[model samples]
Every structure is written in structure tokens, then in C-alpha cells.
Target: MASDMLLQHLDYLLALAAERHFGRAAARCHVSQPTLSVAIRRLEKDLGIVIVQRGHRFEGFTEEGRRVVTWAQRIIAERDDMLADLERMRGRLTVTARLGAIPTAVPASPFISGEFLRRNPAASVRIEALSSREIARQLADFEIDAGLTYLDDEAPPGTRSVVLYREQYVLVAPAANHLMNAPEVAWSDAAGLELCVLMTTMRNRRILDANMAAEGVQYRPVVEAASVDALYAHLSHSGRATIASTAWLPQLGVPAGFAARPMVQHGPRPVIGLVVPDRAPASIVAAALAEVADDVDLEAHIAAAWDAAGDRRG
Candidate 1:
């Protein structure tokens, strides 16, 4: 009876648990609906306990099923780690780097991952744009091997974080805006301007708010958006302004007809870095990333890239 169990069955069960619908779970596993349901039922029999709460439609998991789902996640994660370790020992390692990053750090991903890819030529990459808090949670849960986020104020406890660069803030607006001519902009002065701001839930937005508050100002934006692109759209079309970090300028660039002026703030400047789980499992990609980070002059390289992009786009 024990021989009846298979990793594929567990995979099906996990898919079902996540999707919560037989048809959708089957699609996720690239199998037919009946095939998925049958596999899940097989999992229940092998475990000798009812895993799912069956109903006319797709119902949630049973009590035992929830526990099994937790084990399944751990089992899958350990399997990947074991495979990665074996590949490393054989000196023919090929793996994918799974990374989670805060929104502001997304722009700098290419710079960090590019160097790692050069060393591990066969490796692939996947990056999710998440909040700083979510990045820490994913890293802790073993969902993501690494995270890129703000390191100074709220770095996750018991994690190894290496600072890549210190981020400086600026006020970005269309050249046609009145503030564009100034060598520097004050936060109090910006509070009165039409602005497109990041959602308040984002840590980057909170940091921006704190910086503005330090200068005796409160920035009440005319618009709010989840993505930097959306904020840029509003700022560009409506002659509004947005705050950006110098690190992000490398990827976003100063668009034609726009200028980025340094913000004069006596507030805290955030240090951005790469964060990995404390004593993470035997994952080669995460270790390789740490190794690559140690060898590069990341700060100078990103500064040059940001400047080059500005020159081209400005």
C-alpha cells in the first residue's frame, strides 16, 4: 500500500489545495479534471485519512488535509534543496534563482541578477514584485530563496543582509513644471504641487512620507497608484510630480521632457540590500548570489548605469 504513494500525487494535492477547484487545479497541473481528482483521492488513501472536504462544487480541505498540505510544502522545498546540493557536489549545477523584491528594488534586479547569471550561465531567474514585509515573509517561509529590499530600518531578524547601495531621493517632474528649473527641491515646497504618489501601504511610500514630515510637510497627492509606471503615467500626462530613488533611475530613466531634482531632506536615507534567510537550506542559487555580491562593486556600477540612462533619456 505504501508503494502506491508518489510525489506526483502530492503535487496534484498541493495544486488542488492552492487552486481550490478541481478543474482549475487540473489545468495548473496540465492534466484533465478527472485525472487530478483521482490523484488527490489516491493521496487520501495512501495517507489513510480524508484530505479534502468533498462537495457539489470544490470545497475546502479537511482538518487532516490542512496538515498534509503543510507537510507537502516542506517536502517539496526540501526536495529542491536536496537536488540543488547534489548538482553542486557533481560540479555541474544548473538551477533557477527565485527572488522576491520590493517595488522600488525591482528596477535594480537586472544589475544584481545579471552578474549572477554570467557566473551560472545555465541558471534561470524569476523575480516577484512584493512589498518589503512580504519579501521577508516569503524568505522566511522558504517560498523565495532571496529578497531585495530596504535594509536599514526594518531588516528581517536573523537574516544575512548585504548592503548594495544607499538610496537618495529626488523629486521627478516634467521639465515644463515650475519646479524643474530649481537645482534642488524642498519637501515643503513639493507638498503644494500636484503629485502622483505610491499607495500608503507600501514601505517606500511610508519612508517618503516620513522624509516629507521631517521637513514640516505632509504630501497629499492628487493621485495614488500601486505601480511606479502608473504613477509616472499620471505625473507625465497631468504635469504632476512623483518621488523616486536614484537607484531606480537606472531602469526607469529620466524620460524626455522630464527632470529629476535632488530633494533636500534631513530625514533618514534608506540603505537597500540583498537579504537571504538565516542559515538557509542547501540552495546553490542563493549561496551563489551571496558569492557574486561579495565580488562586485555594486554601488559604483549602479551609479554609472543610472547616469548613463539619464544622459540617454534626458
Candidate 2:
């Protein structure tokens, strides 16, 4: 019974860690702030250490608090794993898996989710558009079950990736824009155009910046947004152009009076893929998602789109 009480308190601690505010964490846990505070204090007394720093408000976690949070995560994960294993054995693995994807990969999510659901009829998916760095951090913290993001040169520890498609860029501009009719646009040429781009924090923006720098092209963007949808919204109202992956164009639908031209003078194509944590005993849902990812023919679809876009230019 004492162990059960400790487990309950651990849940409250993890919620506090995530929310970083006592009131918010209490709300998340469906308890009053004072109740949550008492639970945490009881946990500290049981553990013989202080976990959270107190002040007028929630200051932060102590060093010991951080370590306890890590252990709490592992303990909770193990409990879920046991439950999942039991459900799998009973042939009733019903779990909602959370997938974190970079904003640029949002267009591909429907296909991925559709296929995964088709294979695992009992399982549902929740996809969130996150930055690449956030995806990595979430994966490390077990906040997300899987991630769809660029397969960077260095994979994060405890994670494995499988390439799904090669991401190629294109320039999107209004039909009246001079470069819209061009078969291919060079990085240097794009640098001269008034542009709206992803914020510098995004990996896609960094890649675009590096490609332009390689060609000795330097220019400032007229607008910056965190998501591709915001970029599109800005482009819809102005004559300014934006860079986006070729594979995402079909989903974005060339807006009325807008055209997309393949970017020819860029650096190497970046590979975007599904990344899952490599737990010793993977969750049944993660295993199912990986199996579905292996069967998805994303590359073929991307290639077909690329060829069709080129044919349109001819």
C-alpha cells in the first residue's frame, strides 16, 4: 500500500515537472493545487530528499528533483510496458500513440497515419508538428512515441531512424513573379527575391541558409514564420516567395495564381524519416508503427511527384 501511494505521488511529480507550475500541474493531474503540493511533500518525506524548490511560486526542481523525475519516467514507462505486454498477449492492444513531426513533414502525416491505422485497426494516432530539436528532446524524455524528422548526421542516443523519403526543395511564388515560369530556380537567384521563410530556429531554415551561403548569396527574408502554414498565409497576401519541400507541394496545393518551381542549385537532399526510441523491450504500439513505417512507400510517391512536376515544366 505504501508503494502504491509512492507511485501515485510520482505521477504528481512528473506532472509538475512537465507543467513547471503548481497550479497548472495540479490541473493536469485533475487535483487541486494544495492537494498536489501535499502529495509532493509526502513524496519528499518518504524519499528523504527535497525534490522541488519552493518560493512565492514554483521556482524550479532541485538537482535531486531532476534525478527523481528521470527515475519516475522510467518507472512509469515500465508500468505502461507491462500493461501493453499483457494486452498484446490477450490480442487487444489498444493504445493511442503520439507522433512528433517537424513542421516541414506535416504534409506527409496523413499518409503515415492512414497506413498505420489500416494495419493496427485498434490503435489511433496523435500527430503534433514540432521543431526537429523539440522532437529530439521529446523522444529523449519519452514525451512522444515516435518522430518524423530529418535524419541528421548524428542520430540522438537511444533512438533509431529509418529513412522514408528524400526531401527536395522548390520555390513558390505568385504567377506574376518573373521566376514562376522558370523550369528551375538557382539558390543565388532565389536569394535576390523578396522572400518569406521559416524562422531561423527551424532546421529547414538553417538548411536553406547554408545552401545560399555556399553560393555566396546573402539576403534577408521579408517575413519569418514558425510553421509552413503561416508561411503560406503570408505568401497568399503578398507577392513574396517562400521555399518548401517538393513533396509537400501536392498537399499545400499551389494557391491560385501561384506556381512552384524545383530548386536546382541547392546542396544535398535531406532525408526525412521515422525515428523511434530503441528501448530494450519496445512498446507494442511503437513496434506496430515501425512495422507500418517499413511498409510505407513514401519514396515512390515523392519520386512520382517530382517527375510529374518536371513534366509540367516541359
Candidate 3:
């Protein structure tokens, strides 16, 4: 039994196990099911055990098949690691950034990119749009080089952060809504209002949730939207109201009948920022980028948010 030959069939076996259908696995491997079946049979013969149990409905893998799949995954992982090392040696730096924002800061990312490219021209960057929890998980797995997310709350372990901006939370409603006439309304006045909000998955939504809970205000949002477009769609036809960051308002292009104002006893606004792993000895580009982004006019952004909020009230 040549172990090398068995190793060659490992990929086929794993694919078959994953797809759980012979024809699909063969298609994935670019081979005929008969060819893959023969190869797997040869591998099983060499190992002196049955690996797969055949059936009309693509029945399950044998116990030994599960073990083989585990080994195959480890083998593939090592292969990926080896390829990454080779790519690194060839001077192809692959860094992924998972960024999460309140739909407002999506535009702000390009500003960081200009500076990032200036510093690391040799590196290739991949950007992922993620929610805050997704950003944190990707950072923990070393899947992302850095993330842009809210920095007001306690950060997850093994990460460092720098505030990039502060965003003012404002009340948004159809221009016809009653709150439009008032300069401001307190959180205590928020109850019994039909609201429209970004889905609870967003960090921005969570911040509002906490504030409302603290004020003993209970809101039942008649509309829930996951993105800016969805929020706008609902706001156009109905009297639904929502909270939005001031930076995001001008970009939303709200219809003529829509209005926005700052809340009295304003809720806590999130500090937008970048976060990176606090691992030992950061990459040269990573270290330099963090230093530069941190030194930017972050405090000025905070002041701007406050000033904008004040003007809206006045």
C-alpha cells in the first residue's frame, strides 16, 4: 500500500463526505463518479477497511470515513499554510480588514485606504463589510488585520483600539411626524412611539436599546431594516421614526417630508474607531498604520458631532 497514492485520494474522499453524494463530489473534483469511486475503492483496499457505505440516497460515511475526513482537513490546512508562506516570500502581502459601521462610516473607509496604500504599497488589502460581532470574531481568528467599529463599550479581550470619530445620535422621522416641530424630546418621551430602526444585530441598534432600557422606555418598532436602503424605503411611505447618526443623515437623502433632530438628554453616541489584535510584535505595516490612524483629528470629529447636535436643537 503506497501511502503517497492513498494521500492523493484523500481529497476525493473528503469531497465525497462533504457533498454526501458521489456525483456532486465528482463534479467538484472535475472527475466522473466512476473514476472517483474507483480511486476511493483503491484507497480503501490499501487501508484494509471500508470508508463509505453506498446506498441509493447517498447514505452516510463509515466511522473510518469520519477519521479520514479529519485527517484530510488537517492536510488541507497545512497545504494552505505552506502556500501562504510561499506567497509571503514572493512579496505578496495579503491583509484583510473587516470593517463594521453604522452605514455612515462606510464612506469614511476610503480616507483610511489612501493613507494605508501610501504606507504599504506592496500589500494587497481585502475589505469585508461586517456587523460588529462579526468584526470581533474575525479579529480573534486572525482572519482580519484590523476592523473599524464602535469603541464606546468594553472591547473583547486581546485587542487594542483607537477612536476615529464620534457620531451624534439624532431622531429621524417622516417630516409629517409630530416630533418634527419640537426642538428636542427626552428619552422619557420615547415610549409608545412606533419606530423604525436598523435591525438589532447592529451595534448602533444595541446602543439605542440600552439607552431606551435605561430610561424605562419601551418601543415597538413597526419597521425593522437591516440597511440604509431598507430604512429609507419604509420611511418614505409610512410615519415610522428612527434614530440615526448625524454624519449619516445628509447621505441618506431622506425624502422631502422627512425630518431629523437631536434628542434632549441625548443618548450616548458611539465612538467610531479601529481595533487590532494586541498580539506580540505587530507587522511593520500594521504598526505604522495604527500609529497614523490614531494620530488623526479624532477629537475634532467628536467636537463636530456635538456642534452639529447643538445646531439641530437650536
Number of the top lDDT candidate: 2
> By the TM-score metric, which is better: model 2 or model 3?
2
lDDT of 2 at 17: 91
Local error of candidate 3 at 112, Å?
2.6
Candidate 2 lDDT, tens digit per residue, 33-115? 99999999999988889999999999999999999999998887777778878887887767788999888998887778889
lDDT of 1 by residue, 37-58 (tens): 8888887888899988988978
RMSD of each: 2.8, 1.9, 6.2
Give the per-residue lDDT digits (tens) of candidate 3, residues 1-314. 87777656987887786688899999999999899999998988988888888877568878987787677765654454455456557776454333444455554565565566665576555566677777777566444657777775545567887878777666776666667678776665654566778788887777777778887777777878777566667767666767766655433533566666667644455678878777554544445457767766645644554464443432
* TM-score per model over all chains: 0.87, 0.93, 0.62
Candidate 3: stretches off by over 4 Å: 1-107, 114-125, 188-193, 253-255, 266-268, 298-314
Worst 10 residues of 3 by lDDT: 93-102
lDDT scores of the candidates, listed in order: 0.79, 0.83, 0.66
Residue 264 error, candidate 3, Å: 2.6
